[model samples]
Target chain A: MILLFLSSGLFLGWSLGANDAANIFGTAVATRMVRFKTAAITSGFFVIAGAVLAGGGATRTLGQLGSVNAMAGAFMVALAAALAVLWMTRAGLPVSVSQAIVGGIIGWNLFTGSPTSIDSLVKIVSTWVICPLLSAVFAAGLYVLARAVTQRSRMHLLAEDAMTRAALMAVGAFGAFSLGANNISNVMGVFVSAIPASSVHLFGFLHVSSDQQLFALGGIAIAIGIFTYSYRVMITVGKGLFRLTPVTALVVILSESLVLFLFASESLEAWLISRGLPSIPLVPVSSSQAVIGAVVGIALVKGGRNLDLRLFRRIAGGWVATPIIAASIAFFGLFFLQNVFDLPVHRPVVYELSDAGIERLRERGVDDEGLAELGGVAFKSARGLTGVLREKTSLGMIDRDVVVDCARRERFVVTRKRIDTLDLKLLTVGQIRALRDITGQEFNYWWELESTLTRESDQWAMLPDTRDNHPANKKLRSNLRQLLDAFRTVDTDD
Target chain B: MANLFARTRLLESKIDEYLNHTSEVGLLFREAMKNFLDGRLDEFEERRGKVCDLENHADELRREVERQLYIETLIPESRGDVLGLLEQTDDVINHVKHALMQVSVENPDIPDELGESYLELADYGSRAVQELVMGVRAFFRNTAAVPDHAHKVAFWEKEADKVAERLKRRIFQLNIDLSHKIQLGDFVMHVDSIADQAEDVSERLSISTIKRSI
Candidate 1:
């Protein structure tokens, strides 16, 4: 029974991933700056991490309000909340998930003797009412900020790509992280209410157990959703809305995250509610709305009166229309995903990366975070300290930040073990060769080609023009710790 | 509640998938239109090639819907409505191709802005389709929900109006000969009608989504 609830929670999480993953890179994907796979893998990891870390608060709030008195009730509330939003999404309206769950909770509360806590409910409802308004106001302010900042560093970044690329990379990671923290709760919060702490476990010590299993379920479900349904939404979001410059995407994501985090906080929500103000805390709002609001804010700053009003009207209509319609369909949709037929199998995800491979990452020096994402994956997958480097060693590519993206597809770990290595980090060039003479990566063609092309005798570092160009190498989908561990041993520092 | 909730999530995913698929086709049409309007045969051929499989699958999907027929489409009226929307979805493809093919014959190098204009109309059409898809999903539960998107169809139709005006102005102001002028005028009209139909699809979609959702 516990397992059933957990899996159902996972299903919800997967759907959440599919829907909300779009929030992270919809514009970037739309503009063709990044691929959906890269966004999905990256988003999957950060969202899970965020849910496990920051997702607790939202889970608690949703669990408390939704009248999830039992495992069955939790499932119902979560399912209803998800169905309501998805129904709207399908119908083409973009209703906030937060709104649907809040509504569902209200409906459920009506049945119970909770007697409609008008005081608490009003504050929560008001947030929904006020958030978009606040978002718009904030968007207006952000537009001004964008204009001011653009003026400040206008010429410097026009030529210096290192600083610009670095900034873009940081912004992208930040956006991905924020998406995880805020959105995963939409999937797991209900399940979080029912799960007991005795059931689940994370990396040895990090025992989220059943106490936090719903969040984990939500995170994993979101991950699955990212793996399955999210690509299309990502395409629509990243590629569909408007063509975005990287800086524009950066600005929009930053603004969206800030605004969402501001709203998600319990303390802030309580404060607002106490003061007879509106707050949308503990509910699932549209990441689409927050991002779009921020984006339009950015766009208005760049091209004011010429701001595309037609696009605006159409989008506004979509937001209004998608939900009502989506709900109607989803209300019926509920009958379909469950009763009529069995669900499909979870497919293994394969990531594809375009033109810019690891060499460009090499061109820009690795930072601590970049190294961590890259190296962290390799080490985390390693065996204990007494006997290390015995498992498979593979090349986990670096990012602009130098960290390996931890969101690889189709991986499950069986046990928890800690491994630490000191020799690999301090290896000299001669020592690396002495080591590589026995154990090494099979970039042999890469080595041979680089040796043939370059005149310099001492150049061991090779940037292959077409080596990683086979349409799939843009993003590496290796085990996180394994990739990170392997990266630490690689002699890329030169 | 749990059973109902489960069904809702699945259906929403299914419908959203179809909506996304439709938009992809719309995107292809837009690309092909741009190429055709620019008289870029090579590019037109390239983008046009990508749609054959899409069109085939679209036909297949519709047939599957007809075959299954558990719940009826509220707006499609008859088999013909299904055929009409399908054809209209394909017409978006055909008109763009026809315009491009015509452009190749009359002016191998049509103005870039002409390509730009056609794409703008295509974009509006795509947006309308998306809204209609949303509305149709609404219709899945309730018919009244359709109007939410139906309202936007007018705005998109207004865009079609803008496209018509531009196509007319461009044709009227052109310095081409009478024979070529007539052919160009006919082609531009077809393009305008295409945009109009796309908007019509949105209108119908909103109606359908509303009906289904309710």
Candidate 2:
């Protein structure tokens, strides 16, 4: 059953809630301004709401890193990442699920011999660096702003205290919401490719897609984690960071929420695109890093002399180590899952060099002399296709590239009618609108249609891309127009 | 959990006890000064011993409070503030003990003309300390009243300072040895410092109250 395979993802989600929830409400709860029970309940509710609502946006970028096409593979990847997080947490070291899951996905790619998209990898790595820096900037700005407002109000001390307590709770809830939106992908993202794109009807009234159901399940697991295990971590984080003033705590939480929101908000990205401006990537970022960055921002604003530089360095060291440790665990865990447990980790994907593959190769400028002899040939994997092509022809060094492209061509299954009937429930409203705008556009292949849809889709265009304009997107549009004209002329000849 | 909570409550009460014990230092100083002015060294020593005993009791309570603050995590959120307040408040008691010890050891040659002034100075300092003690209690029980008590402490401190200045001027004009005059002046400064320290502690109490309110 899929439930068995889902256990690892659920476990990862739980750990994420246990660890990251502290970043949101730790200062308030530890300072006793907000009761722990109240903080936990509010966090549990908002985090799930956030995950169910906006969690899907960042999953596509994670899918680009590596598509673990089998449920078993996704299980092992999530398991390895979760184990890594648990171990680091027990060791009293800071670890983030975002970094661990990225490492796990990369390990799965390596184990399965899938080509890692360097573009996605670079984008993810860069965001890891930028997320914290952006948080620091936002935190510094917020700290100054909060100080000015409080000073200007000049309220009675008790009134100011009450206001600060209320603000901390409000900002903490917002931070929890942003955290769920950002980090849910790290928990449930590996299964994105494995989740079926069809909705299941429940009691003839509620229709839930596999993606939504999986996200909801992950959200619930996260909620359970927050309610059960977050208090101790909250205490540690709250006390470990410099003793936070109520105002400083509010500023740190607001800054963290803003950073996570910027990274995960599809609405903001869409607005940026509507204005013809480049949009922010919907990437799941580390909330722990963001919170630490905000605290550092406060320390800097407070003259930077009292910062626990040693603790900062240790935490920084842990950040560097988390991903590498997770990757190693995933890499080795894959072999154990596939061999020892005999699970179907990498599915057997077949590519045929039939008329379709040949036509695609010709369009790609492959030499046509010996390609006819390759008709009806089948390959079980990308390497198999490349090896067979190299053996059968005197093709030069680019033979593997051609075979890889041909294998990719085999993946396109979209048609005009299929795009017309494509499930809107599975897509954001912006994506649905983008698909509608491109209706009746002639595309011979699904890849062409998907790329066109992606370019037009506000959420997709803003996705973090390492390559400038991502060469694949540019080529898809050009090839689709050429193929459409060729189809037109051939119809006239007929 | 309830036990720990009760233990913290008990620790806070002990700290209040310490404050009460330290407050008696002012009363003891007045008593010891009376016996000293009356040439009753034996009586003064008896009361001085009582002051020392109270000081020791306060020290023990302070240590217990500090231990519980660490071990039981009493008032964890404001533990530092409580400890800082305790440490600073203890300084007033130490000043009381030192002033009394100096008077006993030095055996100041108080002229009959200055005996009433000496007693007046002691009375003024003791009253200021009592106000400070009340302010400290208010810091723990009724924060709003702390500033008022601190104001009262400032009033007594100013009165005590004026008495000290008058005593110094009269002692200098007594045709006593320059060294005796300086020693008496030193005694005057030391005794007046008790009120000054109480005012300082009350200022701290005000700040601590403000911190809690905010």
Candidate 3:
């Protein structure tokens, strides 16, 4: 049953592999610079390696887009996005998996009344435009440099040909690696929050988290897609759109690899942040778009006479079509999952007002007398609590947000030993040690532990009541509790 | 990948073979010019016939190279340049064939006073053709060396033209019949055009080489 739920995500991964892997090695294979077999093998191995090692960063951005919070909801969203991509590809449109996944996520947020994060949405949508333009600039610059070197050296034609062939293979492998690292999020990011909280030891040595396992599965699906269906796409990209010299082909591949690496590399983002520069949002962008941008860049540098605008227009049409179709599918699919199938697509999260919630509400200067009457009330989900408080009390969205601090229950008992053994993935070591200092303490409410952790970790500050909850903090707290629950020991002394 | 490069090399080999056939025409022209100067009409006819056969052979090879370039897609990036070069070089071959045919048909009575000058023009034309052949070879083998051979072709072509002009002046100054003098002048112009065609091919070879380099 659980395996069936994973099928849609696997399908998305497969289509992504089928379509996007072409962006990595299509020009090489199509131009006969590299054989299809060699391209597929290199791309398959490196893509899996990249997914297993570096696929974590982009998933964080997708999670911030909107956390679906239910396995059934995640499954439906992935299915909708996959179907949209498959349909677009079959129709011979240039579909971007990142765009489809985003649209599907937005659809879910709308269906569940979860407000979309406009800031993250704008950043991601802008990158879809920016990624290709950046690739174009990089490709043009590299092509000029490559041509100048080839001209100045005046290398023998055969020797130059050999060098170009070797360079294409090396750069193609780099492209495939970046493709897997950046795009695995489109395949399995929906399942991150719902990832099973147990670790699977491979060969009883390497500890593979459930998220990594999902990433590996998605990577394999991409590899399979590359092996089976990428050749046709490669042919189109390689020769049908524009004629490419071997050097131009290598430049295109290198430019695409660099762009993908920029978006997905956490270390690069950290370096930028350390320098007090803005960090790049770790969002999955379209590899196909990047490749096309590179091809166009080369065309522009060659004086812009060669671009097939009709073909490009058709591809651009797919970009607009993908998101709208994906959103529609997700919206209808969620409705079916919730109503017809009797599945909890949006799992109802009921919270009983606790002492900590009321105390936090009072600390934020909410009129205590009016909210006191609703002390013991149980509400289904944070939005439900906000809706009632709006009607009965003088609480605005901000005040309601503060009052809903304990809107979710925490099931973990954070004992000294439990905290010490916690396998939390997102929290830093310092935060974990601070969590450990709260020995023998039990947190039955969400706000109690959050307040205690904020006080203990001098590194973290409790958010002001007027502001919204930080997505990173929310995810960390949720992961910390799950880890504690997994290691929770029975208290016999009680 | 090596397969495509190998096929392109084969195409290049066929072009070299065609160039060799054109160079053979230049050799036959030189031999025929020697025989004509020595008053050996029979041997000149034989040499001219040989140039004709080589021209036919070179035409066949040129056709074959073009067909392979288009059909096999060998060296697709440079296929057009290769085909263009073949066409231009084929003109050099045709001039050899036509000049030799005119020599046999017109049977111009060369004045013994300008016999050595005719041979000089033939030698220059032969040298020009050789230089062009070398330039075309460098185009495929080492594109960077093409300009050097092209410059050599231009030098030999100028020398051939200078000799042809002197021969035309010597034929006109002779006390021969007016029709005979016109025939000799026509013969000299026909022979000089061979070197002129070679110089043109050399220029094209240089241009194509530059295109390929970039």
Candidate 4:
């Protein structure tokens, strides 16, 4: 059953490999600078390494966008996204899997009457525009520097060729790694919420979480796609698109890889924040758009002759059309799966304004006078609660979201059986002791369990979002999420 | 990576050796012409043999370089241009060898007044060939220097043309048999064609240099 639900995500991973691997290795293989076999093997290995190691940051962002809590719904979301990509690709329009997945998640939110986090949605949408622009800037600058070095060095032509070949291989590997790290989220992020919490011990030492295991599976699927299908796309990309010399191809690929890494690297983000600098948001961006932007950047550096306005228009059209198409597909697909197949597409989340929730809201500076009359009212969906909040209270969007989150009701009983099921390998000794201290407590909300754990031990507490504590805060959040996943129980009253 | 650079270095040296063979062929052709004009038949025959051997060796080296380039798939974008340049430069060497061989086969009885002029014409051809070799080498290392060497090749080829024309005019006015005059005139044209072949290679090198620029 788990395999059946994960099939769509695996398929999405395969398609991502088939299409995007070309953007990384196309020109090198096409120009005969690097052999196809070497390129495929190198990219395949690095991609898996990257997915297993650095894929979490972007997946967390996608979770914030809309957590697809039901396995069947997650399946439909991935299927809708894969279908949208296939449809758009057949139409010869540029499609981004990241955009399609976001749209599919939105579709699931609408179908299940869940509220999409507006902040996450805006951040992701803005990256779609900023990614390409950043790629162009990097490409232009790198091109000039590469050209100047080649000219000033006065190296023998054959020696330069050998050097360029080595550089292409190295850069292609980096590009593959970056692509896997950033884009794996689109393939398996929805399943993160759906899959139960577990950890696999490799060789009795290395602990691999359920999410990492899922990403590894997805990574293998991508590697299979590369070996079986990407050759054709790579050849076409080499010959079809802008006629790039091997050196120019190197520049374009390196620029695209840098952009992907910037968005996906948590260490880089931490380092930047530590230096009192703003950090780039970790979001998956389209490799194809990055390639196109790099090519355009080179063209602009060469005086901007023969610029294709029509292609740009098509890309812009795809940005709008792909999401809408995927959203529509997901909406209809979820309806059919629910009504026709008799599947539980969504697990209903009930919201209520109890006394404790109202007090929690009051502590957060939310005026509770307008909400006094609505106490003990149970709303079936997040949207239902949000509607009531807007009508009854003067809280803004952010405050309303906060109210909805705090009022979300769940039964969390810290029983020994549930505690035994927890992946203790993931938590510190202090955190484990804290969990044991509250082993018999019952709570009605996730925040209640969080508060108890925080009060019991400092290890479970989230520090201020300061530069020095960024990593700690991130780890604490991840630990908290795992605990919530373990303890969350269904309400039989529904 | 070390192996890649080693192969590149080996191919680079082979190309240099081939160019050196071309330059040597031109030098030997001039020496053979001078020996023939000075009535040193034995020395001329020795020089002619050496030119033939160098030309054959250069051909073998060129073929090996071309084979390595394809086998290793090195310099893929500029491979065609480099191959064309090497082949055309080989033609210049072949022209020098053929000119020397023709002088040996035809054994034209040159008048005393025309002997000096014939040696001068051979010197001009040798200079043209040397400049063309420099231009080809520059195409490999410094593209900016190719045009300068190409210009020198054209200048020497023009000089060879002048010497050939004057030698021909003097041959026609000689108080000797018309057959001998015509034969000497044919020899002048043959030696002059060597310089013409070098100029042709120089023209190709210039174009290749332009294509190689980023």
Which candidate has the top score in lDDT? 4
- Candidate models: Cα lDDT each: 0.50, 0.77, 0.79, 0.87
lDDT of 4 by residue, A1-494 (tens): 98999999998889888888778998888888888899989989988888989999899889989889888999999999999988887876655889999999999999998889999999999998899899999999999998888777878888988888899989989999998899999999999988775777889878787788999998998888888888877877787766777778899999999999999998999889888888899998889888888888988998997678787788778878888889999999999999999888888888888887788788869875788877899999999999988898888998888888888887877777777756787689999999999988889998898988999998898887678888778878887887787777776421
C-alpha RMSD for every candidate: 26.5, 10.4, 6.9, 3.0
Per-residue C-alpha lDDT of model 3 across residues A105-132, encoded as one tens digit per residue: 9999778866466667888999989998
CA lDDT, candidate 2, residue A452? 72
Query: lDDT score, residue A317, model 3?
Result: 84
The Cα error of candidate 4 at residue A34, in Å, is 2.0
Error of 3 at A180 (Å): 0.5
* TM-score, per-candidate, Cα-based: 0.43, 0.67, 0.75, 0.92
Better of 1 and 3 by TM-score: 3
Tens-digit per-residue lDDT, A54-155, candidate 2: 786687678767777788889988998999899889878766889899988888877876656667788888888898888898998898887777656644
Q: Using TM-score as the measure, which candidate wins?
A: 4
Q: What would the per-residue lDDT of candidate 1 be over residues A286-358, giving only the tens digit for each residue?
A: 6667776776666565565436677667656665554344334433433343356432111112221112323
Query: Where does candidate 4 stray beyond 4 Å?
Result: A93-95, A306-309, A417-426, A491-494, B37-39, B109-124, B151-189
The alpha-carbon deviation from the true structure for residue B210 of candidate 2, after best TM-score superposition, in angstroms, is: 12
Interface RMSD values, listed in order for every candidate: 24.0, 9.1, 4.3, 1.3
Which residue pairs in candidate 3 collide? none
Q: Which run of 10 residues does model 4 chain A get worst, by summed lDDT?
A: A485-494
Off by over 4 Å in 1: A6-8, A111-114, A156-165, A197-204, A265-284, A299-494, B1-214
Query: How should the candidates be ordered by DockQ, best one leading?
Result: 4, 3, 2, 1
